[model samples]
Target: MKISAFGHAWVLRWRWMLAVLAIAALPAGLSAWQWQRGEDKAATLARIARWASEGAVGLDGLGARTDAAQIDGMVLDFEARWIAPMVWLVDNRVVDRRPGYDVVIAVEDIGAARVAGSRNAPARAALVNLGWIAA
Candidate 1:
């Protein structure tokens, strides 16, 4: 009887420890899933940020052959066309302390009408939303 009680107690204690370990594992599992999903997006965004800070490749021939998604994500050398935009269009608005504009820098694309938006932007020459700016 004494041996049985000790064995039973050991089982109970192990059960609780296992439950705690499972609980701790849940968050780690979720984090791993999220990281996998965002791997491409994160890498692409990092490259874009680098391009923004360093410089831009020419808007003309850069994205001609490549698809929109690739052009938007890949960072390239600085180009003169990227400097002077056609116009600063206000793409969105928010009600806050003051009005702010989500702007896209419209630039002429070689085969397309325009190129704007983040580095991960589509290749189509359309209005590309870059980011927010104070009005």
Candidate 2:
């Protein structure tokens, strides 16, 4: 019995075909994942913009919630005293074609006691991003 050309090719080259298919699929899957990530980021940015336009709310208004899932995309406002000496800059930020770092500083919220809903809780320092500056 003789096998057809298509059947013969499949029998002899099945491994190669599988390997090629797997190689092709990897990049396609990765591209899809990256596209989804981009979409998520865009949606998050839009939400932040909309919330910001509605004006800022104090930290105390949001309570003492520290769960990232609850506040990951929130735009918050609070009165804080800058701890200038603890400033740090995050590298690789770009603005208007200029490379720079994002300025971050630790600040103690004056209303932190209210935020924790207690007068005895010690005020905590939080890092705040103050935008990008030229490197």
Candidate 3:
């Protein structure tokens, strides 16, 4: 004729257990979904860096001597994706010519310039070294 205390306790605890299980499962499910989608943040950033660097290097060796303005243009073009928006930065006419050198200084300059820009220093220093812009 008496209601049992054990039965009441089970009912109270079951709800809390279910809530905890749901909270724990949500993060696990999201991570599994991300992995299945092949989304790797680090790898994606590396690829972007490589692509930007290669593009910068290619700008060099387009002519007998690389100019500072040209380097400036390359850096501006590279940063156009995120740094500056809707501005005509790189001068295609200047960079259009290919230099005789096997290695392009602009590419190396671009990589360094990008790093500098991210660090809050003007990318001009790296650009100057590559002869893409004036110091």
What is the C-alpha lDDT profile of model 1 across 81-121, one tens digit per residue? 34364557574576466678877665434333334545554
Worst 10 residues of 1 by lDDT: 74-83
- Model 2 regions more than 4 Å off: 1-12, 68-73, 94-99, 111-124
Cα lDDT listed for each candidate: 0.61, 0.80, 0.45
Candidate 2 lDDT, 22-44, residue by residue in tens: 99999999999999999988988
Give, for candidate 2, the lowest lDDT window spanning 10 residues.
1-10
Pairs of residues clashing in candidate 2: none
Task: Assess the local accuracy of residue 103 in candidate 2 as a C-alpha lDDT between 0 and 100.
Answer: 90
- Root mean square deviation (Cα) for candidate 1: 9.4
Angstrom error of the Cα, residue 91, model 1: value is 8.1
For residue 75, give model 1's deviation from the true position in Å.
Answer: 6.7
The candidate that achieves the highest lDDT relative to the unseen native structure: 2
Query: Per-residue lDDT for 1-135 in model 3, tens only?
Result: 233585563234667778999999999999998996675565655666765686644323334445553333333333322222222223332333643222123222345456656755444322222233311
